[model samples]
Target: MLESEYQNRRKPPRHLVPAAPSQAEFSYTLREATTEDLPSVLALYRHYVRNSVVTFDEKPPTLRAFRAQFEHTHKLGYPFVVAQSPSGDILGYARVQLFRDKAAFRHTVESTIYLGPASTGRGLGRALLTELIDRCEAAGIREMIAVIADSGAEASLALHEKLGFTETGRMGKVGYKFGRWIGIVMMQKSLRRK
Candidate 1:
């Protein structure tokens, strides 16, 4: 192989990958993250970072940074859950983060969820979100937000509405991708206050 080609093939070091899927009935569990789970978590995020607009990040985050993100959220007492099968394959993940960095926005937080391509339509999104809201209520989060890329994410929009979120904002031509410009839809849910 050409030296340039060989150089291009070098991969960055990786973290500990989780064990392979375990065969069992259709069951899943939601729990807080651990240092050990970062690799699997990064793997899932890398999928969307590479293949979809599920998140705005143009490049995959390093596993070390991904692990630190979870650590920070955990310290803030927010919900960050990993859904796993009985044998420990991560099917998806969901987490809540501060809506903005300003002190005044602390009560408001943004919600993000990602599912493995093969795991959609099995109701895991609903389960993950239910737990997210449960944690929000417990932690006294006043408002939850979602900024969805508007090539028209129907399923996401539908799910948010079904979960009592309402459209609060929209920006036209705010996101450019796939050789075109697209809009962004922002939705929110108010919790436990008038």
Candidate 2:
């Protein structure tokens, strides 16, 4: 069908619609997150929570809960960093937290990274994750884990792999979100140099 004919027949689905070319140059600085940044960070997370299965969270997080996480990460001496745009907006965030509460798991951390929808495809995700890994290594962290949604999170899986993570295991049908079954792929990267 001709382009005009196709337009008249049916409107393109929102997800299928082409996005306007980004006009601004992509630029951001990576730095440790502050208490003041908790709100913006949560907003970025809410974007995924509401629209995608990338996160298993079915509801947006409350500020108090997010604050507690921020505090806990810091209290454990883990890194919580953000990518700030030139306009002072938070483009994305990356952080590491204790993988488990047991003392035996002290050297193991779980890495989590999230970028706003508009920040996707830019190099921010890579930069943010790299910084997180570097910080973890600097702090004597021995291992980093990435638990990614197996479905609808291919980009995250690919990013982790590009950063030298390897799949360790997978648990199928472990989560339910958006009324659909989803699973997790566990990826691990050694932060300690041999």
Candidate 3:
């Protein structure tokens, strides 16, 4: 069919991405995540692992594996949060895990956050991250670290900086993924409340 004829046929477009919701229309409840949220959390995370360079994990973790990690963090009294929409959907999730397994690192935590594709640029990340910081402070966390990819994650880096995190250091060409070299930018924030 000619282009004009095809247009006249009124065939619907395919694979179109929906526009992000505006701040006025977007609202969510921020709260601690539960075991029941594991599946949704895992699915949200898999989106990043499969499609984005923000995470170093080239392969998505299994539900069982993610559950094990979540349980460990919960058992250790770390903060795990989910931002749920009014209609009961997990728009994003955040967590703080031990920075290292050593005893000297007990007071330090590494922050991780992931938002759904349609949820970006709607202020959801900032809200989720602020909640994570507040919870980590309440949990007596002295330090919070964010490890972000050097490629295609500038927004995350800027968000961390806007929240009082400083670029502590960087590792160059450490992550090899998607047939290219990627690095990490490490930012840290002191959570010691005066």
Candidate 4:
């Protein structure tokens, strides 16, 4: 589906939707990410890896490792994009990867979005995800799945719900993080109608 077409679809209830980022808070630009952006992207993800259950990685990957991951995504032709400040700082990023390695899963993709700590609540996440969805649909992807760790992540859950994803399943006590058990929430959005 096209971005405009997706925007025209019916949204969930207002209360379920996150408040729009105030104009004063959303003065960034969105664009395709490049290899040079990997350092900043890793930096943003490091926070989540170290302090939050959002990611299960206890230790962040090295720059070379991150670069290899980025290159792999690029080689697969999946979208890897970033939100940038006017001064060239990366505010956030979103990307889509194959949901599974099997040939039958070719039409499905899993999404990952991360924003700088200071960049949250400013609509950058939504913007990045929206673009990712558009690009995925345009590329003939049939489904987008979010394996969201920590079911307590209200903002991330609400954002996906608002964008037409439905809660498909949940896994309990699957991730050990921060000295506690973290549950996973599986949310899915179909980009094309059957």
- Which RMSD values do the candidates have, in order? 13.0, 5.8, 6.6, 12.7
Q: Each candidate: how many clashes?
A: 0, 0, 0, 0
Q: Mind giving the per-residue lDDT tens digits that candidate 1 earns over 1-194?
A: 99987886674435545667985556789986677877987899898877776566787898778877788878888888889888898988889988888999989999998877878888898888888888888888999999888764778888888899999999988776656687889999988842
- List runs of model 4 lying over 4 Å from the truth: 1-25
Off by over 4 Å in 1: 1-25
Residue-level error in angstroms, candidate 3, position 50: 0.7
Tens digits of per-residue lDDT, candidate 2, 105-149, equal: 999999999998889998888999999999999988999999999
Model 2 vs truth, CA RMSD: 5.8
The 10-residue segment of model 3 with minimum total lDDT is: 11-20
Deviation from native of the Cα of residue 45 in model 4, angstroms: 0.5
Q: Model 3, which residues run further than 4 Å from truth?
A: 1-24
Please give, for residues 167-190, the per-residue lDDT of candidate 4 as tens digits.
999999999877899899999999
TM-score of each candidate structure, all chains considered together: 0.82, 0.87, 0.87, 0.84
| Local accuracy by lDDT, each model | 0.83, 0.92, 0.92, 0.88
Ranking by TM-score: 2, 3, 4, 1
1-194: candidate 3 lDDT, tens digit per residue: 89999886685555565766765688899999999999999999998888888998999999999989999999989999999999999999999888999999999999999999889999999999999999888888899999999989999999999999999999999998888999999999999662
Clashes (candidate 3): 0
Clashes of 2: 0
Q: Candidate 3: deviation at residue 67, Å?
A: 0.7
User: Candidates sorted by lDDT, descending order?
Assistant: 2, 3, 4, 1
Off by over 4 Å in 2: 1-22
